[model samples]
Target: MTNDLRARRLALLKEHFASEVAQEFDRTIATFADSPRYEIMPTGQVHDGEDQVIAYHRAQRTAFPDQRHENVRFHVADDDSIIAEFDLLGTNKGEFAGGAPTGKAFRVPTIAVFFFDGERLVNERVYLDSASMLRQIGRMDLLG
Candidate 1:
């Protein structure tokens, strides 16, 4: 039987993904605790608190307006974290950082570690390769 903590964590994770897929980002943000945080390892970018997290998502959408994820699997990592393996697929249909839209696509594997402080998600750290993703999106120069 799942402990109450585990159950709440699992449910939060589910709702998080479901809300994202449904394009209901506001609902997705509701799943987070009062102070939410997100860390992108490759770029050393950190979004802390609700406002920063929202800005982070906006920048992400500006780079890949149609970004979506497919969960490959998930595992409980101790009592406070859940590791989710997924594929992050998206098209470069919108400007990314300083680069213009390429109209290319990228499908890359990613692992996101979701951290919880007893049922409320406090942080999410995602690991992925920027070079490969850039190459997949028709940016061979970024690979150089």
Candidate 2:
């Protein structure tokens, strides 16, 4: 059952991230069997491997320690690709890039696609609407 396997993999990833299971992150991501890559669409930044992923998360947590991501939808492709939609909620209490501690709360929607090799995630592309997020944090003046 391909669908079942995909669901299991998705569950593993969700649990690993939500619970901050470092070992599981390593084990699951290691299934990629090669250097993994992530493309962040909003910023056009590409990150490679587990170390980069960990670093990215560390930076995010440093800036928004209380951030929480809630999954809103999921789509599984025939080729074992997964598209997940989520809502991120958090208060910006620390410096993020140039935001300067807005201490404001924001809810931002994001979508990410994960490509899997067997059970391991090999690649990811994430889409985030940063313009709206910047507006919510009171940094962008275009929304008034």
Candidate 3:
């Protein structure tokens, strides 16, 4: 609630995003509290705990090895949550959703609401337009 607390939370969120873009899963996981959770709102998928969270990250990175964020903006929603908006860009160089790579690149706007307990992150709920991403990557067939 204080200025110092907001600064600390923002710093932690920056570190978390940086580690993820670097594919440093260990460092990313360390930013969390005892338990970590991720929810992809568009897909209705939830990954909870360290193992599941790690696996989820692996799968996504495997599909988009060059995945990175751009034009990042942060909003302090409340004492316990922060919202992030950014452009997620990546090329499909590996299998995704049991389908072969399309050798295409896509950039989609995404929002992730980060929930924290004090300074440590507890959950990240992401919202993105999966249909737009799929269309851009020439994988709209996946929608069927």
Candidate 4:
């Protein structure tokens, strides 16, 4: 890809992350090329289309109101893909995964492969250390 296209992709990705952290759902959704789609690889959960993707974001933010990413690093995997590495940190302040709030915090390493159709994001496939996150948040039982 041309340098201009690469820069544009990175800019949009940064905007996407920032908007999510800011809880600006509209801005976040605007980054998509067409319909929003996200695949949580560890849980085999797919949030497809606009409504599902928005609902998924809402549920996650409700569960972890202080959710944020840290130590972000980006790798240009190809002309149409980018790999983002970061720590997904959050505090359990609300119900999550059918359990009561633990009032605990967790920091799990996460990787999100962002697929692009030209300059706009098409899908984000995330792989995270769910085991570590669950253990830290006092949900070891969920490991089974």
Q: Which ten residues in a row have the lowest lDDT in candidate 1?
A: 1-10
Worst 10 residues of 4 by lDDT: 72-81
Show the colliding residue pairs in model 2.
Answer: none
What residue pairs are clashing in model 3? none
Tens digits of lDDT, candidate 1, 70-142: 8658898766789999999899988786789899999999999998877888889999988889888987776
Query: What's the TM for model 1?
Result: 0.90
**Candidate 4 residue spans exceeding 4 A from truth:** none
Task: Return the TM-score for each candidate structure.
Answer: 0.90, 0.80, 0.98, 0.98
Off by over 4 Å in 3: none
lDDT (Cα atoms) of all candidates against the true structure: 0.84, 0.72, 0.95, 0.95
Candidate 1's C-alpha runs over 4 A off are none
What would the per-residue lDDT of candidate 3 be over residues 1-144, giving only the tens digit for each residue?
Answer: 989989999999999999999999999999998788999999999999999999999999999999999999999976699999999999999999999999999999999999999989999999999999999999989898
For model 2, how does the per-residue alpha-carbon lDDT over 47-142 read when each residue is reduced to its tens digit? 888788667766776667787777657777777687888897777788788557888878899988888777777787889887888878777753
Cα RMSD (angstroms) for every candidate in the order listed: 1.8, 3.3, 0.7, 0.7
TM-score of the candidate numbered 3? 0.98
- TM accuracy, model 2: 0.80
